[model samples]
Target: MTRAGTAPAVLLVVVGLACQEIGASFAVLLFPQVGPLGMVMLRLVFSAVILLAIARPSVRGRSRSDWTGVLLFGLVLVVMNGLFYLALERLPLGVTVTIEVLGPLTLSIIASRRASAWLWAGLALGGVAALGGGGWERLDPLGVLFALGAAASWAGYILASARVGRAFAKLDGLALAMAAGALLSLPFGIADAGSALLRLDLIAIGAAVAVLSSTIPYAFELIALRRLPAAAFAILMSLAPATAAIAGFVLLGQHLSWLEVVGIALVIAASIGAVRSSSRAARETAEPLA
Candidate 1:
């Protein structure tokens, strides 16, 4: 895309990332009342409601593969969101996002099939190691595991979402998959939240979380992805850790040390390098033999 086109897309992505972090901060506030699983259920359920209302996806005459793809996509959503929230409950938001991003970073490197991609991988390892600069024991082991699981699930979500997008038009696939995920989480949500879910105020806040974290971001990203190169989009997404940190500090009073900030910066740098390398490799492969 040209510079003019890239500017708007980059703006959209930044807005989406900011909204996402703000939503996550709100979720942390509700963790005391609803627990992380409850927050996940509320977020997914409300997001599904909004998406279904907007998309009104057709249900008739869909193929079996289409249904299967949506189902798997829904499963990925549940795992990704659930693990992410669980990690957030134990770790700071910025750290959680930084670790979770490794899924996409690894995916980009492997897809690039370039030897130089390993250099970025090494940088990312250094970043992760630096995150525990205070001490490895300072970071919760279980939280790190949950973050890792979220990372894997996020990678699955990207692949599954792409397959579902191909199978359905507009936001139809997303709406259907979100509905499936909501239903799948219903029982667990009810169990975890109990009567706390009955509060009208909490319900209202949950709607806001849905809009900020899922609905608006999805819409913005969908539009931006249409105009932006995948590499450029990935580069923009690498800013999530910084956004999360800002949100955490401003909204949740969670502060990070200088070492942790440096760690986040390193991860962001590695992500950008990996994406640029991948894009360059792709372009070289597409060029005509000279």
Candidate 2:
């Protein structure tokens, strides 16, 4: 893609990420009312409804493999959202997200064995240690564990999503997967909040969350991915913590410490370095004859 073309795509990706951060931080407002599980359930329900309405996926003619992939994605999606929301209940937004990045970063490292991969691994590690600081108490070990669980589930989502994309065209797979995820979340929603889900305000908030977290982000990311290199996208994603921090401050008023800032910087540096290395490798592979 041309620089001019990639520029808008990059901006779209950034905006998509920003919307995700905003939706996540806004979820805090629901903590006292619906609690984490309740909020997750609502978000899933709303997201599924919206996507289904848009995609109108039909399972009747789909292959068994399609069903299986959708199921797998739904399972991971359930665990990811549930655990992420749960972690937020106990941990600060920035801290929880920083820890959650571990899963994807680890996946990224495992996908490659180059020097850049190792450097990213080391930088992410240093960032983790720096964030954790003196001990686990700074971030709460249990909360961190939940965040890690979310992260691990997120890794599964990434891989499954890739497969789904290959299996089906035009993101129908995602819409179907989201529907499955919503169904899987139904039991939990019933168990955790039951009739509370019927409340009008919560429903409104859930709809808003669906727009911010799923619809807008998905649309922007889809367009962006087509225009930008995967390496560039990955590098841009390293700024997740910083966006989380800003979102938390603006939406939730949760502040971060100086040490936390340092940790974010380390991770960002690692992400940038890794992207540079990967881009260089890609360029070498594409080099013309001398």
Candidate 3:
């Protein structure tokens, strides 16, 4: 009965992630001239506002350690998103995102010994390899560098997120991190976006982008995480690469090969197996009579 109640929220989280990826791809069209840094700044600033209003995280009683976690996570978020936007300039959304997935994939394999973890690794590898196999003819070195940078930052975000999640109940950690991230990106955004940011149409478009790609996704994740274990949550998130692939095809018309499709399936299977294993682990840990 309890599990049934949680299923809908968990599904919504995955869907929310999909929406964010697809929406962001389309949203970029609204700001073709806004440049990468400017768009990132706008999204972060607006997302911070939206999250702040929704989560309203208070720092009154938080410990110093908690603040440190928030700061670390905020820094990671800024770096990851910044580099992602930068890479998008030179690389197709599908390619860059697939590469960035490597970080979380590595993270997923770190703590578990279950056969399912290996399955997930296989999926991760297949998805990544498929991306490589269907090579980009004009692969940009700078683009690859930014994508890898995003990957490293993503790794930081994952570890920091774990700590931040532990530090605060509910969405407090995420809310604070968003706020800090916005502050961190302001200077860069203003410099890159410049006076063009003041245009009404651009501001409106940026706000919509923030709502679709950031605010909605974060809310869904918070709700879903509250209902699921961390391991389960991470496993579910492993699907982002597949989701991004589909999103790319739809919004950007970036066609992926059959190998890419197979690759995505492998990763998704691995993630499911990993989550199922974690669920089993949870059961064993909680129940002694079994």
Best lDDT goes to which candidate?
Answer: 1
- Model with the higher TM-score, candidate 1 or 3: 1
Better of 2 and 3 by TM-score: 2
Relative to the unseen true structure, what is the C-alpha lDDT of residue 52 in candidate 3, on a scale of 0 to 100?
Answer: 81
Go through the candidates in order and give the C-alpha RMSD of each one to the true structure.
1.5, 2.2, 2.9
The numbered model that scores best in TM-score is 1
Of 2 and 3, which scores higher on lDDT?
2
Itemize residue pairs with steric clashes in candidate 3: none
TM-score of each: 0.97, 0.92, 0.85
Worst 10 residues of 3 by lDDT: 104-113
List residue ranges in candidate 1 displaced over 4 A.
none
Candidate 3 lDDT over 194-237, as tens digits, reads: 88887998988888888888887877887887787777677778
Off by over 4 Å in 2: 279-290
**Candidate 1 C-alpha lDDT tens digits along 1-290:** 37778888889999999999999999989988888989999999999999999999999999999999999999899899999999999999999999999998888888788999989999999999999856878899999999999999989998999899899999999999999999998887888888999999998998899999999898999889988887888889999999998999999898898889999999999999999999998889889764
State the displacement of the C-alpha of residue 153, model 2, in Å, after optimal TM-score superposition. 1.2
